[model samples]
Target chain A: AQSVTQLDSHVSVSEGTPVLLRCNYSSSYSPSLFWYVQHPNKGLQLLLKYTSAATLVKGINGFEAEFKKSETSFHLTKPSAHMSDAAEYFCVVSPIAGKSTFGDGTTLTVKP
Target chain B: EPEVTQTPSHQVTQMGQEVILRCVPISNHLYFYWYRQILGQKVEFLVSFYNNEISEKSEIFDDQFSVERPDGSNFTLKIRSTKLEDSAMYFCASRDGLAGEVGELFFGEGSRLTVL
Candidate 1:
């Protein structure tokens, strides 16, 4: 079984401030983790993924996440948050050939 | 920059009515999936298809839900009878099935179904 937990349901940040969205996972086997962002009324877009390569993975829009095996965490971070960064983010876990399990999602609210 | 495409951006239907959501996945991708997200809720996996058949499905995908790849380019989800709780945004996604390639899925804008 594979599952993901997004620690925060909502995270508010001021424009230009740092952003962090936490996620943790439980998988019986080695897992592939992903972070996806969904803008209002838009499709879910892949932000980044970790497949046991680098511990730190960089994604589009200046977003990055570090895969911490010991902590069982993959927390997304951005040095500076932009107004456009306001969106709902999901953490997902999938085995090599199984369905992906999604987290409840974290709604990032960027205040200008 | 290949992407997935879905049809019927928004559909309004009465209870017990049937709904069909269509999608065109990225060419050359061999794995397909259908997911849904209720308002303000997390996305839930419904089913995954490969090699012209279903590979896996979730509990939410009851007998009322079905998927098919009719005509080779179009993947579709059919609901025999939609209930009010079935109202949600349905998303289509595809992934390359090449060996040793653990690729991310490409998604479509999604079809919103409103059951009344």
Candidate 2:
């Protein structure tokens, strides 16, 4: 069984301030972790993924996440938040290619 | 930069009516999946299809739900009878065949089904 948990349901950050969204996962096998962002009326876009290569993964839109095996955590972070960054973000865990378990999304609000 | 495509972006139907959601995955991709998000809820896994067969499915994929890969490219999910609770945003996704790398699934815009 595989599952993901998003610690925060909503996060508010000021423009140019830092952003953080916590996520944790449980999987029987080696897990693949992903962060996806869904802008309103748009498809879910892949922000980053951790396969087993590097602990630190950099994604598009200036976002990054670190895969911590000890903690079973994959937390997303960004140094500076932009207005455009406001959206619903999901944390996903996959035991295999197509089989995935998604976390309740975290809605990020960037205040100007 | 190929993308997944879905039809009938939004559909409203009466309860107990049948609904068929269609999708066209990336040409070279070998894995496909269906997921749904109820209003303000977490995205839930429905089913996964690979090699012309269902590889795995979640408990949410009950007898009322069926998935098919017809004509090689089109993947479809059919709800035999939809309920008010079935109303949600359904997403179709596909990933490549590479087994070594972390499979990155590309998603469609989603089909919003509103069951009345």
Candidate 3:
């Protein structure tokens, strides 16, 4: 079985400042990791995905996450936070060929 | 871009009443799934369907739940009986990929079910 843990239940950042959301995973085999964003009352939107390639992956809307195997972490980051960035972020992990698992999710609040 | 779509954005039902939530995945997608999220809880997988059969399912998917691809376009999830705990947001997703390979699964906005 695979699982993901989002370190924080909620994270707040000042607009125009940096943003970081932490996530860790436990998987038996190589895993595929993803970051998705869901705004209030909206569906989830894919942000970035790590499919066993470059450890540092870039995603839409100026967001990125690094897949660190030794640390078993996939932390999402951005240099600047926009009010639009405020939303619920989910860290997902999947096995080589199995069902996907989602974290409890981290709600990001960008304060201007 | 083609995306998944669901019907009845919100439905209210009495306990013990049957309700069917519907979805239409991407036209060429081969795999389909149903997931639910209780109020302020993590999303939980219910079932995955492929090749006209179920590929996998979670323990939460039991005798009360059934999935069907009634036609070439529509995928529906029927709950035999609703309970108060059944009030939640149900999401439908679809992916087209083979084992060991990966593909994106598009998701719908979600259908909120409120069982009284």
lDDT of each: 0.95, 0.93, 0.91
* Better by TM-score, candidate 3 or 1: 1
Task: Kindly list the per-residue Cα lDDT of model 1 for residues A1-108, writing each as its tens digit.
Answer: 888999999999999999999999999988889999999999999999998899899999999999998999999999999999999999998777758889999999
Q: Which consecutive 10 residues in model 3 chain B have the weakest lDDT in total?
A: B96-105
In model 1, residue pairs whose N, Cα or C atoms come closer than 3 Å (at least 3 residues apart or on different chains), thus clashing, are none
Query: Positional deviation of B41 in candidate 2, in angstroms?
Result: 0.5
| lDDT of candidate model 2 versus the reference | 0.93
**Candidate 2: residue B43 lDDT (0-100):** 86
**Residue ranges of candidate 2 with Cα displaced over 4 Å:** none
**Candidate 3 local lDDT, B1-116, one digit each (tens):** 89999988999999999999999999988888898989788888899888888889999999999999998899999999999998999999887776566776578999999999
Query: Which candidate number maximizes TM-score?
Result: 1
Question: Which regions of candidate 3 fall more than 4 Å away from where they truly are?
Answer: B98-100
Q: What tens-digit string does per-residue lDDT give for candidate 1 at B1-116? A: 89999999999999999999999999999999999999998899999999999999999999999999998899999999999999999999999886865679889999999999
Candidate 1 vs candidate 2, TM-score winner:
1
In model 3 chain A, the worst 10-residue window by lDDT is: A93-102
Tens digit of lDDT per residue, candidate 3, span A33-104? 999898888887889999877999999999999999999999999999999999999999866444678899
